[model samples]
Target: MSQTPRYQEIRDDLLARMCDGTYPPGSLLPAEPELAEAYGVSRPTLRQAIQLLADAGYVEKRRRRGTVVRRRKVEQRFMDALMSYGADVEAQGAIPATRVLQARIQGASPEVAEALGIGEGDPVASLMRLRYLDEEPAVLLRTWVPTSVFPGLLGHDFEREGLYDVFAESGLPVETVRRVLEAALPDPVEAELLAIDEGQPCFLFKSVGRAKTGQAVEYSVALYRGDVNTFTVTLTTED
Candidate 1:
């Protein structure tokens, strides 16, 4: 009988722990020396296991923090469907939650103005929020809609209401949405909001929603934690 490779043994055990939540996401594993001693293996052997886990997206190495267990990445389906962030999270069998940090009427900046096709400094209802899945902060969202479109936009309890749902309720429906995705490192506030290290990379999504008449209704920007989320875009040849 052949003996099992030491690294493979360690790798399987670590994966089991991750499944059982023993080493939950965002939690740091024990120091290398401690882990090596516990497993009665050399640091190199333990590292082989750790590398496998990292390669498989089950863990990540932080700049200052050691190897940290990563959350199961949520796959977001886009382009083919205009799914809300909350809906996409729930589809993964995780509880979706929102924390509305700030909501008010403000003047649209040039960036927002360009996206919404509104004039710069135009009065717009702005909302800032943090999106969570299964109690883990995953995305920071900022949205702006011209007050001319939704006069009472800020009056809704956004903590419990999805933005598009509100638009539909107001007798205006978004018929189309355009999404632009980019990769970037999080800024200080965004890093803090998403509960990720500043050094960690994030996905930046900018979207514009338009009404059936081709009127821009909503402009949103989102920062998604790259470690905890994945995106999917489906293409079809059939028109």
Candidate 2:
């Protein structure tokens, strides 16, 4: 192979090391300068190799912390179905729990109204929660439900179970959910609640779940710890 393919070769070698448990999960790898010297390549070439590893989910780059090997991701199926967060976590063999921080009836903010497709000033059930996985805080979820669909939802104790479970118990059938994911810096409140330092990046998700009749039932905005969780989507060709 040509020397131009050297970066690819380096990336492959590093990946092999990871697979063979040389670096192990959560272990920091050598700096670019050290790696470049060891591999007989320039810093840019070494960086390109590192980028390949990072993109493949084998490693992560933190601001103050150096590059570290990532733990194996929990493989979650994205089937076209509605499932509760508790069920999903249990399927992965992890204990899940939710702590309700706040629950109340609130007027729809402009952002909530746009997402839920409801008029401004309409009443919405605002539910804020801190979700835990195996007793570790994993995500901060804030959801708004149009009161017109599920009246008096704010009166229930959501900390004991997921909102989707309550919906099913109330005879609501969720047929479709639209989700968007992005990265954002956690705000002060979010940072405190999520137990993350300020300016740290978090995965932000906005989801709109609708009933079988196509009426929007819930709009949720969630922040997940970037270091501990990852979202995976699988695509197959439809015949």
Candidate 3:
């Protein structure tokens, strides 16, 4: 029988070591020359193995840091239930903080009106927020609510309280939300706001949230950093 490819063999061994905690997250692996020598493979073969790990989000190569294992990606189960971004990060043992970038009342645009089931030119409370996980900028969020549903929402302190909490306190909780997720390259403005390179890939989430009575009450557009964030949805099929 033919032998397993050298690169694949090396890659599998490294993955096993990582899984067994030999290569802990945020820890640097041995230098390429050392690894190549230890594995009895050429430098190119070792690099090919490491490249596979990098592509799978297992490690990152830095200029001065060599190859370091990456922390697990944050998973946002948007389909399972309504969850605050803060809660999701906190559940992963990371600090969650919010910065209120902008809040004001504005006339609804055509798209916003359609999403919120309001007429064009009607007043809406517009909120722009930046979310941070462990002090790293993670998501930029823009949400609009019909002024008729939650008057004076702009007066609340969004930086300290989550939007969902604010809405629930005002008797306008979002019972159901419909979301459309798409892969996008960030614009210059988004790149600056998210502290990422221009044209970096991001996940764009456009959602319409409905009240328990089935009234569309909120429309939001959120951009999440693709590097550190991942979305998971569970699917089931009966045999």
Q: Model 2 over residues 1-239: C-alpha lDDT tens digits?
A: 64658989999999999889898776889988899999999999999999999998889887656897876544334334567778877888877789999998989999999988999989999999999776667789999999998997987888785688788888996778998889898888888887556787788889999988888999999888877676667678999
lDDT of 3 by residue, 47-84 (tens): 99999999988988766458977766788877678998
As for lDDT, the candidate ahead, 2 or 3, is: 3
Question: Which candidate leads in TM-score?
Answer: 1
Q: For candidate 2, what is the TM-score?
A: 0.68
RMSD of each: 2.2, 6.3, 5.1
Q: CA lDDT of 229 in candidate 1?
A: 84
State the TM-score for model 1. Answer: 0.89
Among residues 3 or more apart in sequence or in different chains, the pairs in candidate 1 whose N, CA or C atoms overlap within 3 Å are: none
Task: Return whichever of 2 and 3 wins on TM-score.
Answer: 3
> By TM-score, how accurate is candidate 3?
0.74
Give lDDT for model 3.
0.88
Better of 1 and 3 by lDDT: 1
| Model 1 bad stretches (over 4 Å) | 42-44
Residue-level lDDT of model 1, residues 104-205, one tens digit each, is 898999999999998999999999999998788988989999999999889899889989999999989899998888989998888878877898889999
What's the distance in Å from true for residue 8, model 3? Answer: 16
